[model samples]
Target: MGDKTDPNTTKIIHPVYIVANIQNKVRILDGKKVTYSSWVKLFKLHACGYKVLSHIDGTTPPAKTDEDYESWSEIDAIVLQWIYGTLSDDLLTRVLEPDSIAYEAWTRIQNIFLNNKGSRAADLEHEFNNLTLRAMPSLEDYC
Candidate 1:
């Protein structure tokens, strides 16, 4: 096996976001411009044989606070899970629909991960896992 950082070694090879549009039904731009739908199509085309544009949240969240109860670590783990899960082509795709700001935020996160390949992957992973477990005990199944 070659260096993990090697481009060839990367299993999911594609810029994290070909377009910033993450919301499912909403259009990112006005008119026939770059809507979320368009972005998904573009991403699919560029990703080629690689899987992308998988999960999309089909429903709205139950009433909850807008506050960011999650820490940076938790956010990181969720991002990794989203990417890895999406690559597997098994996770429920409807959970990622483009109308949600949470999805947009997730796209930003994936971009950060792609830009910071040299960063401490293990530390981020640990922090994310811990934070997730603390927030939802049920998540222990995945952790």
Candidate 2:
């Protein structure tokens, strides 16, 4: 995304960060020079349904057949949801008692898979299982 400028209107700015991977490792680009506001915006946008892709040395991602990018995108979305949802739930649970309305809302969101109980539930569960298998300590650990 490129920066845009307008003279007449007030602007809501989003902080941009270059996310890159190197030598099979992922890291934020120019991390030290990033401002706190930018950092917060970067994270907020990421939390709010933005997709961030990783690049190495400005090159296209390592190649795979059609199977790779599609799977990566789905996993990326699930991982992002898990990170943001977990943190939000933790904060809500700590600040509001379990019986509080806010806590109930959080609980409901977390249990959305169960409440929906349809193809969506099956899809999420399948993705979760695949992710769990991939994240296992070893190939023999889980299958």
Candidate 3:
């Protein structure tokens, strides 16, 4: 019988690698809707829940010589698939690229939303209109 302490036979597993039902948990991210931030928030939360946040947190990959590189890349690809599955056809086409890892894909999607001046302006306006004089420490601070 094989012993439990055999490192060669042991395969370390992560939650993200286990396929789960995501129909209700992850909805399509509509770039045209006000739900952009909401969609991104939920996506990040999903990744966080499975402890694969690092794959999508914009961190550089480990060197090929590093012992963790292979495992890191495996998880990165899984995370990348998660990102791809949630995007709509239009967004998927826009963000998809050959051999892109999770971090690269995350940055692409983030830049697309963050650089939207219209959405940014609207969010700013909404916040500004609701700002109170007492919201800040002082009148000058509020202004």
Which parts of model 1 have CA positions greater than 4 angstroms off? 1-113, 120-123, 128-134, 137-143
**Tens digit per residue, CA lDDT, model 3, 75-136:** 88888888888888888998999988888988998888778879888998999999999888
lDDT for each residue of candidate 2 in 19-80, tens digit (9 for 90 to 100): 22221222232223543235334444553433332311122432456557655444444433
List all candidate RMSDs to the true structure.
Answer: 22.2, 20.6, 8.4
Comparing 1 and 3 on TM-score, the stronger one: 3
Each prediction's TM-score versus the true structure: 0.20, 0.19, 0.71
Residue 57 in candidate 3, Cα distance off native in Å: 1.3
Query: In order, how many clashes per candidate?
Result: 14, 0, 0
* Model 2 CA deviation exceeding 4 Å by range: 1-67, 89-143
* Per-residue accuracy of model 1 over 45-122 as CA lDDT, tens digit each: 533322333322223333345353333233333433433333312222423444344345446534443455556567
Top-lDDT candidate index: 3
Candidate 3: which pairs clash? none
Model 1, 73: alpha-carbon shift in Å? 42
Write down the lDDT that model 3 would get.
0.82
In model 3, where is the ten-residue run with the lowest total lDDT?
17-26
